[model samples]
Target: MIAAGLGCRKGTSAETLLSALAAACAEANISRESVSVLATGEIKRHEPGMIELAERLHLPLHILDEAALKQVETRTRTVSKHSLAQTATPSLSEAAALAAAGEASELIVARLIADGATCALARSKDHS
Candidate 1:
């Protein structure tokens, strides 16, 4: 499965999230429809923009807890001090994507930051 993981500031707009997702997917050379799921840190499970984005995409939104997030932190290529301070993870987008992609997943796209939001992509180990 290919998953897109997102991280955003509180109250981020849906348009911003969409744009970020678009840019990230473009960088990874994948269509948004190819994304099997949208993933994020558990703390963002209730974020309005994220909820809206998932609904708009008609995809499941997977929420990864802190432990799940931490497990993949070292695999993330990008580090944001602000994100670390806010989410207690160096790379929420990468971590969430890797976690949702399941064991041995690898990042297909590192974190891509846009206005108020960040996005990354990962693929399951079993996927080619």
Candidate 2:
């Protein structure tokens, strides 16, 4: 992952956001069956279909405080098979953080998805 791969505005819709995440994951060659997702705000605060969509994807959901997300790192170990160009975005780290933190809104996530990205569900490693 690079830095800030996940970039979004503030307050996007749920469907769009999920699509971006899915695209990011696909780009990374990561299977949805293998990763968990972190969401900001309370369960009730999310969109109506979010929970159900997550469940269908078989992704575990972890809730985080948006402020807590600012401290997290998005970049993971680099893949030898990939170069900077292959990544979904210029900043894999930021993208990873957004995927994990949901700092940006659904609309932003959707845009990235439309632009072609593989988004994944991530949680902060800081959690036990």
Candidate 3:
């Protein structure tokens, strides 16, 4: 399974998110169609843009709590000061991708920066 973890500022728009996803997908050398799920922090569950993007893509959205993100934060590559201060994680996108993809997941792409958003991709070793 492949997952795309997303982190965005408040009031981010779905178009901006789609652009970010495209950049991240490009970085990972995979089409957006390859992504199986969308993941984000639980705190962002209420973000309308995030919700809209997921719905638009017809993919499952997995919201991970702080504890869940923390469990895999250490495995992430990029260290965003904002992410650490706001979410206590080195990288929300990276951690979210790893955590939601499954315990045995590995990051396929590190943080891909975009306007008011960030994304990372992960693949499950067991394909579960």
Candidate 4:
């Protein structure tokens, strides 16, 4: 399964989130329908843009805690200073994607940034 992990500024619009997702997927040469899930930090569980994005995608939104995010932090290719300071993780999108993609997963796309959001893609080795 493939997962898209996202991070966005507070109060970001759903359109902005969708644009970011599209750009990231385009860079990865994958369609939006290929994404099995959306993932983000638990702190964003109630974020309007996130909620809207998941609803529009018709995919589950997996919320990862700090520990889960940290598990994949070292695997992130991109670094966001603000994300490091705010979330205590170097790359929210990459880390969250890895976390949600399940065990034995690796990042297929590094962090991609748009106007107000960031996205990364990860794919799992265990298809079963």
Candidate 5:
């Protein structure tokens, strides 16, 4: 599962938080459906973009209160603070490997994560 939390920053914008989520998902080989993304802070503020991302990627996103998110975020690494698309795309198998030992599931998650980021950026830009 890919997990993301907006660390050390209060009132961080949804775009910024989503960027971190996208980055972690890229590295972990997780997708919207295969993984559950729990975002810290207010979902209402992020509803438009989050919903759009979920629909495009077919992912289920849960926006939790900060305190609750923190409880589960203790051990996970956030890695890149920015989006992962600017980096080179991984091969199908390579991307899958990051997800799990299972070949088929990994590839699906990787592709969805990558595609979800694209949908997010596009949707956000349109709002801007």
Candidate 6:
């Protein structure tokens, strides 16, 4: 399964978030339809943009708490200094996607920063 992890400002628009995800998909040469789920830190559970993104894609949004993210942060390909301070993880999007995709998942696309958001893609080898 393909999972996308996201990091965005509290009031970020869904369109902006989608644009970031699209860029990640393009970089990975994968269609958005291949994404089976969306992941983000639990701190964003109330973010409407994230809810909208998940709804629009018809995929589950898995909100991983800081603990879960921390568990997999080391697996991320890059670090976001801002994210590190905010969530105690190097890359929120990368760590989130890796955490939600399961133990055997690997990053297919590193974090792609956009205007007000960031995104990364991961695929579960167990499913692939």
| Cα-based lDDT for every prediction | 0.92, 0.40, 0.92, 0.90, 0.33, 0.92
- RMSD (Cα, Å) of model 1: 0.9
Q: Which stretches of candidate 2 lie above 4 Å from their native place?
A: 1-18, 41-44, 73-111, 115-128
- Please provide, for model 2 over 19-117, each residue's C-alpha lDDT reduced to its tens digit, 9 standing for 90 to 100: 666675566556544444534333224544445555666655444344443333333333212213433333333434455544332212221333322
TM-score attained by model 6? 0.97
lDDT of 6 by residue, 31-91 (tens): 9999989999988899999999899888899999999998887799997779977888999
Clash counts per candidate, in order, are 0, 28, 0, 0, 0, 0
Give the C-alpha lDDT of model 6.
0.92
Quote the lDDT for 118 in model 3: 91
Those runs of model 6 whose alpha carbons end farther than 4 Å from true positions after fitting are none
**Per-residue lDDT of model 1, residues 10-86, tens digit only:** 99987899998899999999888888999999889889999998888899999999999988898999999987997
How good is model 3 by TM-score? 0.96
Candidate 5 versus truth, CA RMSD in Å, comes to 12.9
Which stretches of model 5 miss by more than 4 angstroms? 1-23, 29-33, 36-40, 43-47, 76-128
Candidate 5: how many backbone clashes? 0
**Model 4 score (lDDT):** 0.90
Candidate 1 lands at a TM-score of: 0.96
Global Cα RMSD, each model: 0.9, 10.3, 1.1, 1.2, 12.9, 0.7
RMSD of 2: 10.3
Per-prediction TM-score to the true structure, in the order listed:
0.96, 0.43, 0.96, 0.96, 0.35, 0.97
Return the top candidate by TM-score: 6
Clashing pairs in 6: none
**lDDT of each residue in 4-118, candidate 4, tens digit only:** 9999999988899889889988998989889999999977889999998899878899999999999888888988998998899998989999999987999989999999799
**Model 4: runs farther than 4 Å from truth?**
none
